[model samples]
Target: MNNQQFQTPIEYLKGVGLSRADVLKKELQIYNFEDLLKHFPYKYIDRTRFYKVREIQPDMPYVQVLARLTQKEIIGEKRTKRLIAQAHDDTGTIELVWFQGIKWVEKMLVPGKVYVLFGKPGFFNNKAQMAHPEMELYIPGAQQKGNLTLQPAYNSTEKLKQFTLDSKGLQKLIAGLLEQTAKDIHENLPDYIRNRYKLAGRQESYRNIHFPNDANQLNEARYRLKFEELFFLQLKLLRNKLLRTQKFKGNIFESVGDYFNEFYHHKLPFALTNSQKRVLKEIRLDTQRGVQMNRLLQGDVGSGKTVVALMSMLIAIDNGFQTCIMAPTEILANQHYQTIKSLVGEGFIEVALLTGSVPNKARKVIHQKLEDGTLNILIGTHALIEDKVQYKNLGLVVIDEQHRFGVEQRAKLWRKNIIPPHILVMTATPIPRTLAMTMYGDLDISVIDELPAGRKPIQTVHFYEAQRLRMFGFMKDEIAKGRQIYVVYPLIKESEKLDLKNLMDGTEIMSREFPLPKYRISIVHGKLKPAEKEFEMQRFVKGETQIMVATTVIEVGVNIPNASVMIVENAERFGLSQLHQLRGRVGRGAEQSFCILMSNEKLSHDGRIRLNTMVKTNNGFEIAEIDMQLRGPGNIEGTQQSGVLDLKVADLTTDQEILQQARNLVIEIFEKDPQLAAPENQILNLAFQAKNAGLSWDKIS
Candidate 1:
């Protein structure tokens, strides 16, 4: 029952020689017995029923038919050639066709022989047919030889089938493997967890997962395996969090002092939402605890996340420790600089901006102030992490859109000070709880789920190309009310040429409709220079231009309260999160803003669902959950880069409860055994260490 037995190479397994092993390794990544064991079935089939030919229906799913093979012949020629065999039962006849491996199939066919035929039933040319059906010689009382509750079906490629490594072949190999190793499956979970959750034993789970005795047993096996997968993942993340707090020291912001007090009382733009207040309190507690604070702040666009970040930075400054905020782009970084400057008012606290485009002379002065004690706050893009940009006791770093920056880039910021700075990463894209538990599990999380008072929700509507004129009229009405408009396109220059063309064409139509002098319109896209894009953005912001046509380049950080209408052309081409962000561009001001989604009359099902979801709700978290369901966890932004979303059985979209249970169990275990030194937990500790052997970033948020 040694664990090393599972590590044996897959080539050494019974029934698999060198050639079949090569195919399995190449096609399925099954290099060892462990990999093969974890390769669970996608589905299962019931093989107890034998259908009569008369009972066969075209709409039926996979069916088994025990009938006599009366005749066989090849139909058509060359590419169209197929081996068709006539299968007859007591009532009627059906056709079994095979277009692939025709010669091999013909060699196996025998006239007047009874066989079990299994495949999907289809009605083509007024006759029942089963294409590429699996055939086996019928034998009476064969069911007595072995147990047949449910048959496992594995995914296989046509390349594997050529070597007879299809689902049936794989099932046979798994059965043999289980016979030898099922009893040797070592238990990793403690007795307490098993008894509390009523989970199946590791050995029983593995055996039933591949070959179950009944439906209840199959369910138990699936639940146990899924729980085990997610349990280990949560254990790694929680242990990382525990180790980080113990190892990394952060500069303590013991005092709130004049800056934070002044901003909260006198200079505040608006009253804080309950959720925002809660998040600030959480940050306060973390910073006061004197431990490195690696917290993720989630809020919807215009939910006032920047305000929260600025307030936290003010606390650091009050404690006589400088702080900085890094953004993903120059525009966003500049935007944060301007917003914080205005919020701080003139001469309150010394703040400077550094970016790639900053003049050398100006950068020198800023660097001097940063090195001295004069600069209280510095904000920039990736430029903040440059070697020359040293801080005089940098205590905190607030990174906007943190995913855009690489881990190494963020790590460099930590190295700026002797004590690693507190990290507060802000993201406007709302992350579902299950995803946050797995992806950002190492970091503490806070969410500003509510928006500020008096801000109206944006009204979203979908329109077809035929209704373009009506949309234009609506835009004109909004412009008449002294509000600006944003028309965003999903344009990619290198790949989506048609989309680029669409942007240009749409701009031309806008120019013709609302010509320059009275109705000023500015055009912008990714291809434009930074200065050019900024100039266009400034024009729209200044109200000099009533309309701005651009790409998704403006999806983030270009905030104008006066811009009340967002017109997204070809809306179906965008994802749910992108569409939500685009809609957020409006509804910033007091006016009842609108988001117009324009697309072709013909729309895909997913496209329709995305549009409908946007129109139905304004809650970013709700939209995020639905988006994860539609696109899966890996495809969502910021998650694919985590490398932790590679799940085998537990789905983030559906197994939220299971994930919560696994996380809770990890928390409980850590509370009782912080070092996992308990005798029953030795296997768990070893497995956890093996799982995270070379990952150095576990200590870094």
Candidate 2:
């Protein structure tokens, strides 16, 4: 049987053969054809043209010269034979040294033979030298034509180095495979769609990505591929959402602006922001469509999502259907229940809470009530999805902070009823539109782009650990005004073998820094029990735990509006998206809030960018774009599980222009033949099925 192609590495080509193949397969997992094809060049060395040795200088990255090998000598004896060969062009001569085996070095080099060489020029003792530089013995018809063309460099497993199965050898293997792997014909966008969207062809894009042959071709390929990734991804998501909406045929909740009027007239709390009202109106329209509604409602911290959620639930109850909200953690679930339970005529809409911590008897009672349709609305954590818990006529399911729950877990809620309840997933983290479209493909999207009037944007600051005393003083001032603060860290435990600090130590430091009677403090981390966690969170909410030092377990753990300060220790340890989520914990109320990002001096370039981004904007969307740029799309969107299968050749985030073009071509081809049974769409079908099939994203991730 022919080999089953692999993906992501270039070490598996046929000629790589046993020893070298084993290195690639075991060390780097690059054991198949597909792997080599997708292994992108980290950096390219252009050998498109050449320059004389005289033109080369110290520290120049590229040097092309025609030189004669003046001499060849083995400097070191037996165990370490160091082959040193001197080659000179008309301009100057340079030493080429190899420290490993000298047997092949002697044969590869012949004195007084002129050979053209291209390598990084380094200066040593006032002379140019290329240590172990890549060389060619200038055989007629053997050397490449141009002096420099972008040489594709690849990474390989260390073991592969033993058999000389490194980048150069692997590139040799790929050149052969590509020769046999026929140039796929370009799939033209249908004349109409191409003209409409001004997009490129799918086939041409693929060819260009790997073998652009020229710069323009490379650009064309890159643009088409990126576009395809984003477009098809968006298409699949939008299509799934559209199909689900079509299948739902949900019960329409008659538009009751009168309820808003009544609530506003009487027990109303405050005016809703234009964004909140706009999102609510969108939800209202979705729910009134006579089809089940599954929407992801996103807003920044304290942007009134709970209000929108409650209003949507009210629409369901107003239509006589039951609704439930599930939170990832007890603190959050309980908090949500507290805020959502009082939206309507208190006693009019029955509400109940069930969590793992609930007493067995009370739990059974609540379960019975839920099954009997007595509870108008329910809110809880994982306890809500337990097999023992059943909902009577469950019409809507609202999940908060959708990232915390796995895809299957969220999907489980649909099975709670014969007709899957309309699922509305909410997240305080405002994912950018492109990311949201792909990440939350199974649901429709609605963004709350505005905040309520009078709500001040959270003031964000990035500080080093040295500024601890000043930060502590600032916190003390906020606390003096009767507010709270949260100090967060990255790790839960200290590794005895390692020196890096942990939350426990950070907690200890904060304890010492703020010490005793001056401030009350509570420490909550993953190691704590649920009840213990709830207890500490309760105290924090009640203003007992004046300073809460914890780990990122609190990323989605709790929402303390009164907790006006968010201080993240070693902030560089977290991702941009995570930093934003942690920051979202604060600024939940009307009072002004602040987020302090405490990073160290040794922050990575990307980490610095992430920290700088947080310091610049409270806008999650902007942060998401920056996150996408920093972390790439697959990672930024929590799509790592499916990311490999999600792409064929392009990075949806970085190569968006190419993705868009490919998508237009895909659509054009598909429109011409729905089943992709046509000759043109045949390649498209193969690409998709080959990628998506045999792929259990859950397992791989």
Q: Pick by lDDT: which candidate is best?
A: 1
lDDT of each: 0.88, 0.72
Write model 1 residue lDDT over 1-701, tens digit each, in one string. Answer: 23788889999999998999999999999988888888889998765578888888878878888889999999899999989889899988898889899999999999999888878899878787899987888778775322245778999999999999999899988988999888778888878888989999999999999888678889999899899899998998888889888888778899889989999999997999999899999999999988999999999999999999999999999999999999998888989999999999998999888999999999999999999979998999899999999888999999888878777898899899999999999999998889888988988999998889999989899998899899989988988889999998776342544433367777878999998787999888898888998898888888889998989988988889899999998999999999998888888888899999998888889999999998899999999999999999989998777677878778899889999999999999999999999998988887777666677843453
Error of 1 at 336 (Å): 0.7
Per-candidate TM-scores read 0.92, 0.86
The runs of at least 3 residues in candidate 1 whose Cα sits more than 4 Å from the true structure, single-residue gaps closed, are 1-33, 45-48, 73-83, 99-107, 144-184, 211-214, 492-501
Candidate 2 Cα deviation (angstroms), residue 509: 3.7
lDDT of 2 at 2: 16
Clashing pairs counted in every model: 0, 29
Writing each residue's lDDT as its tens digit, candidate 2 over 526-636 gives 889877887887888888878988887777757667888999888887888889889888887889999998877787899898988888887888888888888777676
